[model samples]
Structure formats: C-alpha cells, structure tokens
Target: MAAVFATINNIAKPGCPTHCGINTVSYPFGIGRECSLDNSYSLTCNTSYEPPKLFPISSDDFEVYNISDSEVRVATLVSYRCYNQRGALGGIIKGFDLNLNKEYTFSVKNKFTVIGCDDYTLIGGADESYVSGGCFALCRKEQEVPNGECSGIGCCQASIPKGLRSYDLTLHTLLNHSDVLSFNECGYGFLVEEGSFKFGGAADLSTNYSEFVTRLESTVPIVLDWVIAPNKSCAIGVNICKGNSSCYDVEGGGYHCKCNNGYEGNPYLDPGCQG
Candidate 1:
C-alpha cells in the first residue's frame, strides 16, 4: 500500500498560485483554468474580500472554507420554519440543491439534524443508499428538552447514507408550535458536519429566530469528498501516478494515488516518492 500523507508538498501545477487567503489550494483543484486538472476543478479567487475569498468558478455564492487532497469544505444551507405568537406561520427557509457532478460526493461525516419541540423534517433526492428519510423532535414542555444532547426530546439527529451527492430538506411541524409556543416557536433543520454542533438545551428553543439560525450558518460547514478519474479504473484509465507511486481503486468508483512504501512525496508528481 502507498503511504498517504496530508503534508504532501508541491501540490499545485508549476507557476500556479498556491495560497488563496489563509488556505492552501492544492492540485486537482486550482485557482484558474491553466492550473487545475480540468474545468470542473477550476476555482476563483475573489480579491474583493479583505484576505481574498476562494470559490468554485461555477459557484460564487458558496465560499470555500477549506481544502485538502481528498476533501473540500464549504458553506452550506439551513432549512428552518418559525411560527408567530398567534401560531401563524411567520417565516420559512427551505433547503438547497447541490450538484457536484461525478467528481465529488457528500461525505458521510455529515448528519441530518432537526431541532424543535414539535417538528419533523424529511430529506429526499439523495443517493440510493439514502433516498428518503425523516427525523422528528417532540416535547410538550421546554423542561423536557435536554442540554448538550440530541436524543429526540427536542433535538434529533439521523445519519445519511454513503455516496450522498445531493439532497433536499422539507420541514414540518406537528402542531406548528401551537402547544409549545411559550418555550419553542420555531424549528431548525440542516445537514452539519458531525461533532461540530452542540444542542443548547431548552434555552435554544427561544423565539429569537435569526440569531439562532445565523449562528449555525457561521459555524457549521458541509464536507465534500473528491476523487480523480471518478469514472475510470486504474486498469482502464490513463496514468496519473508518477514515479514510485501506485494507483488504487476507491470503493464507490474512483481512484487515488499514493507513494510506495519507504518513500515520501507527492505521488502524482514526477520523482513521485523519496526514500
């Protein structure tokens, strides 16, 4: 097996800009057409921002948070619904559509979450392993909800299946906060990177809608796994590996290169590995 290290250096194409703001823009992903492996991997550096922001050339609205050899992190959307004091629908923010083509897939590291006293959320249009599912949170009183825990009391979490490329969310309320109005007036649902969220107990059930939703938007991110030659196998595709490098097939249909044993360096580059 080839040794895969996160510290592989000289990742970008020759003469291409490597740093975008605070993050390292690696190869297979680059800041421009001439640098990236292909147009699908092309990125844009927005100098309009203070430190300069990075975004996919295809999507300027989604800012790039971080990038690695195997994965990329970006800002995600939130689905929410809130009711006014009179039990009338006050606002609604639905889910979003993500189309990453064949080169990327949503990592399994994310979990679908729903937070509310009388809310239920359904997710659809994902990969086959997880085509459709829902999570529900119910509580008659604020005191019934727990702090720092998501066990379906007032907060519930569900696992998405492997190979999830895209999905949409639809939120529903059993009673529209009719019974839990005093303590809970809204419901929130989103796909978040696991271990990045913490339920704030009953206090989170407050009616201050924007603050609560904005907090999620600013802190949580969505993770996407990327691969090279996704549709071709090592035996049939053109070689991407260089000296001292070997190619291996990824489980769900893709390939990755790694440095041979007892060597170190970028496997995709010439003089691929060093002793």
Candidate 2:
C-alpha cells in the first residue's frame, strides 16, 4: 500500500502535535480539545498499536489514514458474502454512519464497488431524501472476468453522491455463488476512492478471505472533504483568511481559503502566502 504524506507548514495550532504516527494532524483537526477548532474535529491517538493508531473522536472504528489541507482519508471495511459447497456459510454486510458535523462531508470521488461472479450491492444514505447507488457484478465463468475492469462483468462500480455524509451497504447475489463456487466462493463490496483501486478479477475472489480483506483495507480508504463555517459563504461567514489569501465557496455549501496565485503557503496562517 502506498502512503500519502502531505507537505504542510504551520498547519497545526500553536503548541499542538502535528503528526500522529505517520498521519498528519493539521489545524481544524487535532488530537485534543484545545488543539482543534472544536470537539467534532478532535481525534484520538492510541499508542498501543506499535506505530500507534489515529481515529476520529466520533468514529473509533475508522482509523485515520491520511490528511491534507482540504481532505482526510480513513480506513474502511469491505462487505462480503461467503458460501460453502453445500450452502451459505457466513458473511458481513458492512455499514458506516459517519455522524459528521456540518463542517465535513463525504467526497464524490468515491465509488460503490462490487466484485464477484454473481453479486450486486445496494448503498443507502443516512436519510431517505439522499440518493442511493448500486453496483451489480456478474459473470458466467472466471475466464470471462477481465483484469482491472469494473464494467459489470465480474466487477462493477457506481458513483456515490457528492455530499453524502453517511451510508450503509447491503450485498445481494444472483445465485449465491452456487454456480461459480469452483473458482469464486465469495462476493465483495465496498466504497473506495475512485481511481485508487483496480479489480484483480478472479484472484480477488479467492477463498482466503482474511488475506484478501487485509490487502484491500491497506490499499483503499474513504475520502472526506472538510471546510470551515459550513452552509455559510465567505460573504456571510467570519473571515479566516490571512494576508495574500483568497476565500472561495465550495460546491456543497462551505467556504475554503487558498493562497493567491504565484504564492505558496498555508492560507489560514498568520503570515499567509509567502513570496
């Protein structure tokens, strides 16, 4: 798995820690009370896990993967259905409820993906008003499945909503893997960052569920977009932009600060953009 380490200067609040293990703890997101803008942005750093682990204060199940100026990535689970030769064995229908504050939202760059010989997954958002996405993956034989392809053969993908804050998944199968048990014994579904992963075709449907799951979690993560004073534009919200910085409204109802053209620096900092 490739790790992303963002280069940031003056990103953390004064006297606060900047890094949790290998993950960055930038401003607006911190490890302690006073360190962050508010409690909803707080994180937890557990040192018991060798290199230590970082998680959002709201969701201990999701470990912090990486953080940039406008986005944060976290580890996610894969929903799966397993079957034995005779009948259904057991499986998990992974679901997540972010409970995020208004300041944050799930980015649209994620795709609802499913992989199997005869499987389809449905994703429902937290509220009925929000739209849902589904993926259906079906194949007659292992030979028909294409490698790195997710176009409704052995693998399929669907785009998630732009401002989805929470969602749960349910996996359904056409034949319960009864017809494709010889080579594929399980079906898998997940929400992953678009372009971040590619299906391995038949090799990914292996019976060795533990190894396959571990590999997927390490390589793929859910992306979230963060903003300040959500639902309020720069015209109405309190200005947080520093010198040589400009404020712009994000599409989903929030505002962000950016360093002006030809300058590079943290836009929220005192010194702002540097020449």
Candidate 3:
C-alpha cells in the first residue's frame, strides 16, 4: 500500500508577533513597509496623540479609529442645514461614495436624533436609489419627554440600514415652524456613532443655538468589510505560499497564511517565517 499521509505534507503554525492590543493584523495587512502587501495595506499606530490615532495604510490626514480582520471603522463628517432671515435654505456637507463594485461597503447604524415640538428631518441619498426618511416630534409641553423613549410625541429616533455607501441629509419645516417658532425655530439632525448618544431635554432654542450649529461638523463611525478577491482560495492549485507555509480560507472567500510547524515570523513574507 502507498503512504497513508502522502498529500498532507505541511502543518499550520503561528508566525509574526502577537499581542497587537485589540487589533489582529494578519496576512495581507502589515504594520509597516516590511510586512504589508503594498503601501495601501499598511497601518500606523500613533502613540503621540491622546487617544492614540491610527493612520491609513499609506496616506496621512485620514485617521483610523479601529480595524479588524474583516472590518474597519473611521470617523467622517456630517452635513448641515441653515436658513436665512428671508427663509432661503442653504447647507454644507461632506460627500462619500460607497463603492460595492470596488469592494468597499458603508453602514449607518447610529443616529443623532433631534427632539422638539414640531420638527422634521430627512436623511437621504444612496446610489441611484433616492429614498428619504426622517422623524417628527410633537409635544404639548417640553416637560413630557421621559428618561428613555423615542415615540414621536416628545421624542423620535430612526435606525439606519447596513451596506449603505452614500448619504445626504436635509432639515426643513414640514408644517412651517409658525406654531412653535417661539421655543423651536429650526430643527436639527446629525450622524452620531452608535451607542455613544442619548436623548436629552428639548433644545433651549433661545441660547444662540451655536452648539447645535456645530452638529454639522460631527462624524458618524462606519464599518467596512474588505477581502483579497472572490472565488480565489490560496489552496486551490497554484503554490501561493512562498516557502514552508500553508493557506487558510477566510469567511469572505479569501485566504490568509500560517507557517509550517517549526517556523516563526510571517509566512506571507518573502522567506517563510524566519525560524
């Protein structure tokens, strides 16, 4: 009889320095030029900053907040809406594209909701599918808002969907702020990080409202999923691993690596994990 273990030539092993805090950067992702696939896949941990910023794989200015094997989260700007005394509407916003074709996906899981007497806000725009939705708050008095509730009477909140790429928000006076103009003149809207916000008392509309105006500068944290390619497994046929390494399939149809038993360092490197 032939050898029973003829095809099982290699066994998987651990490589590279572990303990990258909460993050786990495996193959295809590297800390610097020496371990990355290219400049675009690199990550920098900035210890100088107060919260410890994480820079993009190559460029600066685009600060990274969190990264994982399959997903990443970044801080982004939200749009604004303002009106003049003559009743003309004007606003400013940052535009983003969620290119699924390019393998980048966007999501809106958190909401910066506004609550007041007679308010209407709209969050819209995602590719060609233009759909707009918002919340309405009506109340007889300001003291009715309970500790935790968003029932549209004194408070309201909306949940955004997953896989959303682009978004533009607009605030307006659906019923014409004539009734509650004394206490609530302009409504508010913002894209806040999920789980980091809570509903407060009705905005004191007379306090210059400058703080509310700054909502436009806020950014919502979004998660993205990345992959090497579709239908391409490292174990299929070609010997993708450089030397004494093995390949393992990931959740999204991609493949990463492991060193063949006694080696160390990164198997994805030129020399199979330095023993």
Candidate number with greatest lDDT: 1
**lDDT of each prediction vs. the true structure?**
0.79, 0.78, 0.51
| Estimated TM-score for each candidate | 0.89, 0.89, 0.56
- Candidates sorted on lDDT, descending: 1, 2, 3
Question: CA shift at 256, candidate 3, in angstroms?
Answer: 7.6
Candidate 2, which segments miss by more than 4 Å at Cα? 89-99, 262-265, 269-275
Regarding lDDT, does 1 or 3 come out ahead?
A: 1
For this target, which candidate reaches the highest TM-score against the unseen true structure?
1
- lDDT: the better of candidates 2 and 3: 2
**Full-model lDDT, candidate 2:** 0.78
11: Cα error in model 2, Å: 3.2
Q: Compose the digit string of candidate 3's lDDT tens values, residues 204-255.
A: 3322345654432333354555544435776672265667777777554556
Question: Model 2: per-residue lDDT, tens digit, 19-88?
Answer: 7777767666788878887887799888887677788777676778877778888776787778778747
1-275 per-residue lDDT for model 1 (tens digits): 11122344547788998777776776767889988889878999998977777889987756777876677777766788888888888765555665676888878998899999989988876555458888999999877788999999999999887788778787898877989999888898888889888999898888477888777776777788888888887886537887887888887888878788988777776666788
Give the range where candidate 1 is weakest over 10 consecutive residues by summed lDDT: 1-10
